[model samples]
Target: MSETNDTGTAAPAPVSNWNVPNALTTLRIVMVPFYGWALLVDGGDSVAWRCVAWFIFGVAMITDKVDGDIARKRNLITNFGKIADPIADKAITGMAFIGLAIIIDTWWMWAITVVVLVREWTVTLLRLSILKRVVVPAAQSGKVKTAAQAVGLGLLTLPLLEVDGWLDVPGEVVYGFALVILGIAVVLTITSGYEFFREVWRQRHEIREKSPERRK
Candidate 1:
C-alpha cells in the first residue's frame, strides 16, 4: 500500500512482520526439535514418551493450521511467515517419517518414508523457489494430502506396536488404519506434486509466449 506525497508520487508504507500468525509460525518451528526428541526418546518404544511426542506433534500441527487461518483472515501474511511456515511443516513431518521408519526397522517402512520425504521436500523447495514468480494455489487433493498426512502421521506417532497382550490387537488394528491413510496421503502427495509442477511450467510458458521481446 502507498500514499501520495506532496509531489504526488506514491510512497510505500512498510508493514510490520511481527504479528500473531508469525508468532505461531515461529512457535511451530521451535517445537520441531523438541518434538523430534520426544519421538525418539526411548527409541520411540515407551508408551508414555510416545504419547508425549504425539501431544507435541498434535499441538504443532494445530498451530500450523491456526497460523495460516489467522494470517489469511487478519491479513497478517508476511515474507517471513511464508518461508518459516513450510520449513516448520516439513521439518516436523520429515522427522516423523524418518523417526518412525527407524523405529519400525522394516525395509517396507523405510521405502515408504524415503518416497514420501523425497516428494515432500522437493515440492516444498520448488514452492519457495517460485514464491514470487508464480502463485500456485493448493488444489483440493493437496489439501486432502495435508490432512491425511497429519492424521496418519499423528496416529503412527503413538506406541501402536509396543502395547502387549490384550491391547496388542487393537493397537495393530489402529496402526493398520493409520497405514491405509498414510498410503492414501502418499498417492495424493505424488499426484498433487505433479499437478503443481505442471501448473508452474504452464504459467511460465505462457509468460514467455506473451513476451513481445521474444516474439520480435
Candidate 2:
C-alpha cells in the first residue's frame, strides 16, 4: 500500500516495526513495572532497593536515547515509533516522578509532578487528535525538558542521602540541585506545550484554507 504525495506520486513505503528501535522501545515499556516495583515496593527506603530502582531507571533512559538516535540515523522512522516512542518515554519518566513524590511525601513535589503529568498527557492527546493532519516534530525545548527530567529524576531516584557519608556530600545540596533541575523541566514543559498548540492551530488553519469549500 502507498500514500499519494503532493505531486500525485506514490510515497515511500512505511518502515517495518521489527527494527531495533522499536524493540528498544518495547523493552523500555517492559522495564517500567520493574522499575516501579523496585522504587515503591520498599517505600524507597532501603538503600539496596533504591539503587536497584535507579539502575533500572537509568537503563530505560539510556534506551530512550539509543532508540531515537538509531531510528533517525538508520532511517527506521515509522508511525509506530513516532507515536509509541513518546508514550514510552512519558511512561518511564512519569512513573519516576510520581514514585519519587510518593516516596518523598512532599506536597510541592507532588504538585509539580501533577502539573507536569497533566501537561504531558494533554499535549500527547492533542498531538494524537491531529496526527493524521499534521506532523508535529519534537522541538528542541521538548528534548531539553526530557533530558532535564531524566537527570533530575535519576539523581532523586538514587539513595543519595543514604550515601552522603560515603560521598562526603551533603544530601541537602544534592536534593536542592535535583529540585532545581526538575523546576527547569517544568518551565520547559509549559513553554513547549504552548509551542505545540500554536503549531496545531497553524496547521489547522492551513488545512481549512485549502479546503474545497474555502477554495470555491
Candidate 3:
C-alpha cells in the first residue's frame, strides 16, 4: 500500500538503511580504532604487530570495495551510504597515513600526509554542503588515488627487513617503492580535489540559473 499526499499523488518511499552494503560500511567505521591500535600498539616496531596492522588494513580496504559493489549490484544505494561510505574510506586510510607518518618519523611523510588529509577533508566538506542538490560519484582518478594509498600503506605497514630474509630483498628498496606510490597518490589527490571543486562550481551555477528568483 502506498501513501498519498493531499492532492492524491503518491509519496516517495524512504531509503532503507538495513542492507548488506550499509552493514559493511558500518563495520568499516567500527574497525578504524582497532586498525589504529594494531598499527600503533608496538610503536610500529614489532614485526608481528606490523603484520597484524597490515592485515587489518587490507581487510578494511576490501570491505570498501565489497560494499560499493554490493550497493550498485543490489540496487541498495541510499543517502546514508553515499555520505557514510566515503567517510569510512577516509577514516581508515587517514588513520593509516597518520600512523605511518608517526611510525616513520620522517618530515616528508608527515608533510605528504598532512597535504592529503587537508585535501580530503576540504573536498568532503564541499561535497556535504551541496549533497542534497548534487551527487558527485567517485571518479576514476579518485579510485586510482585510493588504490595507490592502500598499496603504499600496505607496503609501509610491513616490517620489511625485520621479517625473515627469505625474499632476500633490501628494506630500502621496498621502502623506496612504497614512497613512489605514495607520491603518486598525493598527486592524484590534488588533481581529483581540483576536479571536485570544478564540478561543484558548475553545479552551483546550474542551481542558481534554475532558481525561480533568477528567472524573474
Candidate 4:
C-alpha cells in the first residue's frame, strides 16, 4: 500500500524494501537457541565454546541494530515487524539470562530472569490486545531497559572467558557487577511495562466511553 506524507505528496510502494529487514529479523531469532546451547548445555569449561558463544551474542546484538536501521531507512516497517521484533528480542535475551543462571547456578539470576520474562510477556499481551485500536510505540524507558539487559547479559557471560592470572580482578567481582546491572534492568523493565499498560488502559477506557452501548 502507498502512504501519503503531510504535504499530500504520494509515497512510493513499500513492498520492494520490506523483505530484507524481515530476513535480518529472522536471523536474529535463529541465534537464540545456539546461544542457549553454547552457554547452558555445553559440557566442560572449554574456553573455545565460551568465545564462540560470546561472539554469537555480539553478532546477534549487531543484527538488532542493523534490522531496525534498515527498516527505518527503507520504510520497511510492517505489521510482521511490529510483532516479530519484540518476540525475537525477548526470546534471545530471556534465554540468555536463564542460560546464564543455569551455568552460574545462582538463585538471584533465576529470579531476575523470571522478573524480566514476566514484564516482557505482559507487555506483549497488552500490545496484541490493543493493536487494532492504537499503536503502542516503543518508549524511551523501554529502550533503556533493553540496553541495560544487553550489557548485563554480556557481563554475565564474561566469566566464560579464560583469561590468565595476569588479569587483575576476580571473576566473582565481575559477576557481582553483572548482578547489580541486572537488578537495575529489572526495575526499568517493570517501570516501562507499567507505563505501557497505563497507556493501554487509558485508550481502552476512552474507547469504551465513546461506544454506542455507553451512550445509553
Clash number by candidate, in order: 0, 0, 0, 0
How would you encode candidate 4's per-residue C-alpha lDDT over 67-146 as one tens digit per residue? 99988897789888878887888788887877776776677767877887888987886676646896668899999988
lDDT of 1 at 26: 86
* Model 3: CA > 4 A from native: 2-15, 164-170
The lDDT values for all models are 0.89, 0.88, 0.87, 0.79
Task: Indicate the TM-score of model 3.
Answer: 0.88
Model 1: CA > 4 A from native: 1-13
Report the Cα lDDT for residue 52, model 3. 88
- Summarize candidate 3's per-residue lDDT along 87-140 as a digit string, tens digits: 998899899989988898899889998999999988887676645787677789
TM-score of each: 0.92, 0.88, 0.88, 0.85
Candidate 1 per-residue lDDT over residues 115-174, each given as its tens digit: 888988888898888556778898999999999999999999999998999999999999
Q: After superposition, how far is residue 109 of candidate 3 from its true place, in Å?
A: 1.0
Give Cα distance to truth, residue 42, candidate 4, Å: 3.8
Cα lDDT tens digits, model 2, 131-160, are: 688887889998899889899999899887
Alpha-carbon runs more than 4 Å astray in model 4: 1-18, 41-44, 160-164, 168-170
Which candidate tops TM-score? Answer: 1
Model 4, position 180, has a per-residue lDDT of: 88
Which parts of model 2 are misplaced by more than 4 Å?
A: 1-14, 164-168
